[model samples]
Target: MLVTRQKTLRRFWYPVMPVGKVEAGPQPFTLLGEKIVVWKAADGDVVALADRCPHRSAALSLGWVDGNAIVCPYHGWSYDGSGTCVRVPQRPESNGLKGRVVPSFPCTVRYGHVWVALGEPLAPIPDWPEEDDASYRRIDQFYETWRCAGLRLMENSFDNAHIHFVHRDTFGDIDNPDPPQPAIERLPYGFVARSDVPVYNNELQKKNLRDDSAVTIRHITARWYMPFLRRLHIRYPSGLDHIIVTAATPIADDRCQVVQFCFRSDSEADAPARDIIAFDRRVTEEDRAVLESTDFDVPLDMNSGVERHMPSDQPGLLMRRMLIELLAAHGESEHTRHDAGRATQEQKSSS
Candidate 1:
C-alpha cells in the first residue's frame, strides 16, 4: 500500500536537512512525495515552505534566500517565512502580492537535524538525554539517499534476525542464526526494545576496544519514535557506550534519506570519527542492497498473506499493528485502504 498518502504517516515530523546545510541557501527536500524548500532566515531560524514558485511553477529551491524571504529566480518573486508573497519586482509592491501566499509547515531544529511537520504533530521530537550530558563525544555521521522506502529501513533495523546474515562481515555471529526474542514494551507513539546478542568482534570493535575476545555480547536498548526515528544505546562489556541515532526520512514511495549520528564514550584519540563513520557506512549499505530489491511498500494488513512472518519478526509486526491502529484512530483506515489499492493498481497499470 502507498503509506505516503496515509494520515498516520503525514501527521509527524521528518528530518529535512542538517542544521549546517540550510544556511547557505534554499535546500530542497521531499517527505511523503511533497516538495518543500528549507532555508535559514536572517534571524537564524530555519523554516520551510512549498517548493513551487506559485506564479510560473518554478522550483523555489532554485532561488536564493533574501533577508527573511525566498526570492524566485525566475521572475524575482519573493515570499516571507509565513509564505506571504512580500515582494514582486515588476509590479507595485502590494498590488501583485495579493493572495499570492504558499502553505508553510512547522519547522524546527533538533538532534542536529532540521525537521518539518506536514501536520500538527501529536508528540515532541524524541528526546536525547545523552546530548546534554556533555560526556559523550558526538559525531555527525551520514546523510545520503538510500534506494529503499523509509519503512523498509525502519523495519530492517528493528528486525534483528537479519544482522547475523546481512552483516556477517561486520559484527554478526553466524553461529546463532535465529536470535532470541527481545523484550518489547509498547509506548504511546512507538515502542522500546531490549536485547542481548552475541556478535563477532569485527574491525570496528577491535578499534573501539582492544580486547582479543572473538565475540562480545551487545546490550542494546532501542527506542522507536513514531513514523521514522530510531535510537540505539549499546553497552559493551569493556564499559564503552555507543549510542546511534538514525532517522529514515521518506523522500518518496521508493526512496529515503538516511541521516545518522553517533555518540561515543571514548575520545577521538581512542577511536577516530572517520573510522567509525566508514564502518557504519558499510553496514548500512549492506542493508540498502537487500532492501532495494524488495517492494517499497509494506502491507500493514497482517491478514493480507502477501508476506510470510516468522516469530523473530515481532518488532516489525508490532510496528505495523501500531500504525494500523493509528489509522483507525484517525478514522481513515477503510477509506485509505481503498485508495491504496487503487493507487497501486494504477501504478501497475501504467507501468
Candidate 2:
C-alpha cells in the first residue's frame, strides 16, 4: 500500500493569482497546496491566511470585509489582517479570544501577480524582463491538471527531441528529420536552452529544407524559477520578437496545475498568437492522455523505475535532479498528502 506523504507547506513561494483579481475585500486562492484567502487592507498591504474560519469551519472567503478585518458570515466571527480573531459576536465580553489566530502567510503583489510565501519569503519574486514595459501584453491561460509531476511536464517544453514525436505533423516533422543538438546555459535561477533545429517551424522547414536549403536557427530561452515555474522566451527574429510563455505549476504530489502566461511582442502578427494558443492546448491535451494512462503514481525521486536518458535529455535530467535535491533540503519532500479536492470545494463554498 502507498503511504501518504508528510505535510510540509513551507519551502517555496507559490503564485496564487494576478494582483488585480484580488479585490479590496477578501480574495481566496490555492497556494503552497493549501486553500488561502487574501485581502487588501486599507493600508495597502496584502494579507493572506488559510481560508478556513476557525469558527464552525466556515470559509473565511465567504466573510465580508469590514475595514482591515474579515468578518465571518457564520456566527459573525471577525479576523484581523494578521488572521487573529478580533471579535466573536456570540461572546463579546471575553478575553478567551486573545490567542485565536489562523494560519497567516506572507504575501506580495508584484509584476501583475499575487505571490504567497509558504516559508519566510526571504527573496523577491522572479523578475520577467518584459513585465515593466507598458507595451507588453499579458494573457493568463490555464490547462487541466496533469497526472505527471509539474517538473516533468515543464521539461517537455525544453525538450526539442519530443517535438518530433509528440507534436509531429502540427509543430514538427520527426518522421524523416535530422538529429537535434541543443545548446544549453545554466543561469543563476534557472536554465536557457536553444537549438538551430530546422523543425522549429513546420511550414518554413518544409519550404526551405525540402530542397536541401539552409534553415534558420530558433532560439528558445526558458527561464526557470525555484520550485516549478518556467518563463519561456522564444525568438525567431524573422518570425516574432516578443513571444513569451510563463507557467506556474504547483504539484499536489504527482498531480500538477499548469498555469500559463502567454505574452506577445508589441510587433508580432495576430496569427502567431492564435497558433501558439491552439498548439499549446492541443499538445497539452495529448500529454494529459499519455500521462493519465500510464502509472503516474510512481515515486517522484530519481530512482523511480522509468525508462531514461540520452544527450538530448541531459538538460532536463539535471534540472529535475536539482529540483528534487532542493525540495528535500528545504524539508518539502515529493509526496502528496494534501487533498486538493477538499480545498477547491472549500474555496467555492466560501468565495
Candidate 3:
C-alpha cells in the first residue's frame, strides 16, 4: 500500500537536495512517507534504500560505510549499493547471505541536486535548462517542506487568483482595486498567464529602487505523473530571455517536499543568487500557510465531492480533475487503491 501511494514520486527520479548535502556517509530522510537512507559510495555513486536493516530492523543509516557497502550497526550485516547483502559477520556458511537483498531505490545527480526515484525507473529524469542553452544560469535550488499535499501546493503556485489577493502585500497592491485581470492561455505542454500590470509592491517594484514599470507576467507549464509527482515550469515577467523557474513536487500526502531550480541569463553575472532564494522562500512560506489551512482532517471523498470553486479557480480545478480521471483509469494498475479508500471515506463522510 505504501509503495502504491508513492508511485508517482517513486516512478520518476526526484531531486532531493543539492549534491553537496549528502557526502560519503549515510544520510537518512523520508519521502512519500517512507523512511529512506541515502549515501554516496566511495566511487561517487548515490544510493537510496529503505532505512531499516533486514536483520534486526535497525536503521541502516545508524551504521557506517565500509568501502562501497553499508555495514549495519546491529549485527555487522552489510549491503551494497544495489541492496545486495554482501556480507554477514560469523555467518559464512549461511544461505541467507546468498541472494538476500534489501529494497533499494535508484538515484542520480543532475543540475547540482541528488535525485532518487522511489521505485523502479519509469523514465529517465528529464534534463532542464536544456544543456546547450547558453542563456540560462543556475540561480538557486533547494527543498521546502509543506504541511499540505504537494498537489494543492503546486496548484496554488500556478493559481492566478491568489496573486491578486493572498499576495496583495508583496505581489499585489494594497489599495489597487482595479488589478489587471490575468489572461491564461494554454501552451503546448501546459499553460501560461500574462498581465502587463505591476502586481507587487516589493523592493523590485519601487520606482527609484528598480524597474518598477517592467511588466510582470508569469508563464506556467504543468505535467502530472501521478501518485503525486508534478513538474512545473514558472517563468516570471514574460518575454524575458529564458528567466525560468522549474520545480518538481512529490506529494507525501498532507506533507509535500518541493525541489525548485531557478534560472536566469548566463551573461547576467551581477544577479544576486542568494537574494533570489530568500525572495522565493518568502513567497513560499506565504503559500505554505494558506495550503496548510485547508481541512485536511476531512476525508478525501468529502473533500472531493463537496467543494465549491470560483471562476478564478478554473485552471487549478481542471488540472486536478484531469489527475482524477487519470488516476481512476490507472489507479488500480498503479496499485493506488488506498487513495480510493481515502476518497470513499470522504464520500461517506460527506453523505
**Cα displacement (Å) at residue 152, model 2:** 2.1
Per-candidate TM-score against the hidden true structure: 0.94, 0.77, 0.78
lDDT of 3 by residue, 112-151 (tens): 7787777776566655545457766675555767666555
Poorest stretch of ten by lDDT in candidate 3: 295-304
Q: Write the per-residue lDDT of candidate 2 for residues 261-347, one digit (tens) a residue.
A: 666564334444455556566666766666555443333455654555677776667676665665565676565323445667889
Candidate 2 lDDT score relative to the true structure: 0.62
- Model 1, residue 204: distance off in Å is 3.5
- State the displacement of the C-alpha of residue 221, model 2, in Å, after optimal TM-score superposition: 1.4
Query: What's the true lDDT of residue 55 in model 2?
Result: 63
TM-score: model 1 vs. ground truth: 0.94
lDDT of 1 by residue, 1-351 (tens): 465777667778887788989867899888888999999988887888999988999999999988988899899899988888988888865644766478898999987889998888888888777788878888999899987767778888888899999998888867789897889999999999999888887766687676778888889988888878899888999988999988888887778899999888988898888888888888888888898898877887888887999999999889888888888898867233557788899999999
Off by over 4 Å in 3: 1-9, 92-96, 130-132, 174-198, 205-210, 214-251, 266-269, 297-304, 331-351
Model 3, position 303: C-alpha lDDT score: 51
Candidate 2 clash pair list: none
Each prediction's Cα lDDT score? 0.85, 0.62, 0.62
**Descending-TM-score candidate ranking:** 1, 3, 2
Backbone clashes under 3 angstroms, per model = 0, 0, 5
